[model samples]
Target: MGKVYIVGAGPGDPDLITVKGLKCIEKADVILYDRLVNKELLSYAKSEADLIYCGKLPNYHTMKQETINTFLIKYAKKGKVVTRLKGGDPFVFGRGGEEAEALAKQSIPFEIIPGISAGIAAPAYAGIPVTHRDASASFAIVTGHRKEDAEEEVKWENLAKGVDTLAVYMGVSNLPYICEQLIKYGKEKSTPAAIIERGTTSMQRTVTGTLGTIVEVAKKEQIQNPSMIVIGEVVRFREKIHWFEKQAENAYPVSGVL
Candidate 1:
């Protein structure tokens, strides 16, 4: 029986894919990719490989998780080298663990290849370090989205008052709620925060403001998902660095803090 490979395709930049992850794409007989994965990477696949789209948007799924698992099992059982390519590290909110568990239960041989998660890469490309020697020494990655009306399990108190920096994923839709929680739970309303939209790509856009004003800034900027929210003093560094935006300016020439 052929084995299954669950691989990370990195954030958005096609070049950021790890060597091993790229190899999986090249050798796979069937590739199931997510919405956020860079389409450019598909060029590396073998001539006859079958590419499947399994992308999901907020509250909408093109392919159900169970269907994906069934495909992995069915293809592997047929002796096909199957690759499940997801955006970002498969284990880091990419549902890699669930897929792995399904494979394990079926006794299917599989390998997991990790990729660069946007939590760090997004901020880096935006010139904001998640952790700095003086401004920040501790960092936390938290999910910005949750089931509708779901109980809030995230420790906002600790995250607000304890963590030195926070890299929030998929939190743009709930920006107001996130800001209010942090401030209500002990974070300073004046704390600096920034959003890096479509980060690590030529289309990257960044907006910076205090916790109290970021919601308005995001609204005005029309920043959308596939974005990262970086909070803490580390965000202050963007004014000094922000090299990617500068590079983008040379190529795309955007206006005003994007």
Candidate 2:
């Protein structure tokens, strides 16, 4: 049976890809890549290898979980080297855990290649650290949507009180609702918030405002899905610590979405 490699492509930057992941793709017989992986990164794949799109959009899934699991197992039975490439870190909110479990069920040999997670990368691009001395000591990364419980059941109240830094994935569409709940549940409405769109890419955008006004700012700016919402005092440091400014100076205004 074939060995499977779950690799991370990093955020949107091709250069952000790790040497290990890149080497794997270059020798892969088949590559199953995520939707957010930069298309240019695929050029490293073997010319004769097959490329399959298993990308998922926010609030939507392109392939059923069971189908993907079954497909991986079925392909491995053929003794080919299969690579499942994912965007950002494979284990961080990427469902790579489920994929690993599937591989174990069949006793298939697999390796996990780690990459930078968008959660950490996005905030860094916006000049906000997830942890800070006065700003925050702890942080939590969570999805805005969950099927098993009411939105309230996801424990926004406790998180609102417990975490100094909150990074919500799949949160753009639910921003207003989530923000309102946080404020209502005891988080400071005046707390600084920022959205980092297409982080680590030249087209990346950093928008900052207060929690009380971020939803309005987002609406005014038309920031859409696949974006991250950061809430904490650290966001206030953005203006002073903006290092991506150097990169921004060199970044041309690329035409197209970020």
Candidate 3:
């Protein structure tokens, strides 16, 4: 049986892909890629490599998770080197763990390749460090999307009181709810916050405000998903060191602070 490599394609910028991840793409016989993956990486694949699209939108799935698992097994059973390329780290909200479990159940040979997640990368590119010596000492990566049927709610209380920095993913749509939870759980309403949209790419945009004002700022900017919501004092650094946006020729104009 051939081996399977679950690879992270990084956050948008093709150059950010790891050397090992690039090698897997270069040698794979079959590649299943997600929507958020930069298409430019596909150029590294062998000419005969089979490419399949498995991108999913919010509330819409182009390819079901079960179907993806089936394809991985099918390709590996055929003795073809299979590469599953996903955006960011496969384990971070990428549903890569579920895929790994499926492979494990079947005793399929597989390897996990971690990639740079947007949570950290986005904030950094925006010149907002998730953790800093003076501004922050604790950090947390959270999902903005929560299932209504989830057995337990996210521990917003701890996050508000314990964490110094929060990098929230897939949260543009639920911005108001997130802000409400944080404030309701002891977080200061004036806590600094910022949204880095389409971070790390040429099209990145950044907007900043307090927890109580960011919702309106985001709405005014028409920020969309694939954004990182950063909450902490570190966000104040963006004005001084936001180097990427200054260098990005195509970056969107910065929105005014509230």
Candidate 4:
């Protein structure tokens, strides 16, 4: 039986993929990659490798999760090295755990290669640190998406009063609801907030505002998904140390999306 490697492709930039992850792609006989994964990295794969697209969009899934699991099993059982490449750290809201569980049930041999998650990488690219020595001592990564009409399970109370910083992913759609929950749970309306769009890439755009006004700001800027929402005092540091935006100005200048 062949082995399966579930690798994180990193957030946006192709160069950020870990060495081991790259090696997996180079050696794999079959590769199943996701939508957010940077296609540029595929150039490293063997020319004979079979590339399969498993891209998923919000409210739409190009390939079902079950289908992906079946493909991994089928490829590995055929004695072919299989690689399942995801956009961010496999376990970090990338559904890597689910895939791992599927493999375990089938007794497939596999290794998980971790990649930099967008939650942290996006903020850093936008010149916002998720954690700061003085302003923030704690951090949390949260999902902005939720089931329609489902009961909310997020602990907004603690998130508002306890956590020093919050990195919210895929939350552009529910920005207003998120802000409302935070404030309803005791977070100050004037608390700093920012969203980094297409972060870590040449097309990166960052917009900042307070919890009270971010909704309007986002509407005006037309920010969309694949963005990171950062909330906390650490966001204030952007004004003084925002480096990526400067780099883009001098060298990278907002080029078209990759």
Q: Pick the candidate with the highest lDDT.
A: 1
* Model 2, C-alpha of 161: deviation from truth (Å): 0.6
Per residue, candidate 2 scores C-alpha lDDT tens digits across 162-251 of 889999888888888889888988888899999988887877787889889999999999997678889988898898887885667766
Misplaced by over 4 Å in model 4 are 147-154, 252-258
Whole-model lDDT values for every prediction: 0.93, 0.87, 0.91, 0.92
**Candidates 1 and 4, the one with greater lDDT:** 1
Which regions of candidate 3 deviate over 4 angstroms? 149-154, 249-258
lDDT of 1 at 179: 95
10-113: candidate 4 lDDT, tens digit per residue: 99989899999999999999999999999999999999999999999987999999999999999999999999999989999999999999999999999999
Of the candidates numbered 2 and 4, which has the greater lDDT value? 4
Error of 4 at 68 (Å): 0.4
The CA lDDT at 13 in model 3 is 87
From the highest lDDT down, the ranking of the candidates is: 1, 4, 3, 2
Q: Candidate 1 — which residues are off by over 4 angstroms?
A: 147-154, 252-258
Over 1-258, each residue of candidate 3 has an lDDT whose tens digit, in order, gives: 988999999999899999999999999999999999999999999999999999999879999999999999989988999999999999999999999998888888999999999988888899998888989999999888866653324477788889999999888898998899899988899999999989998888899999999999999999998789999899998888889988864455566785
Q: TM-scores of the models, in the given order? A: 0.95, 0.93, 0.94, 0.95
RMSD of each: 2.6, 3.2, 3.6, 3.0
RMSD of 1: 2.6
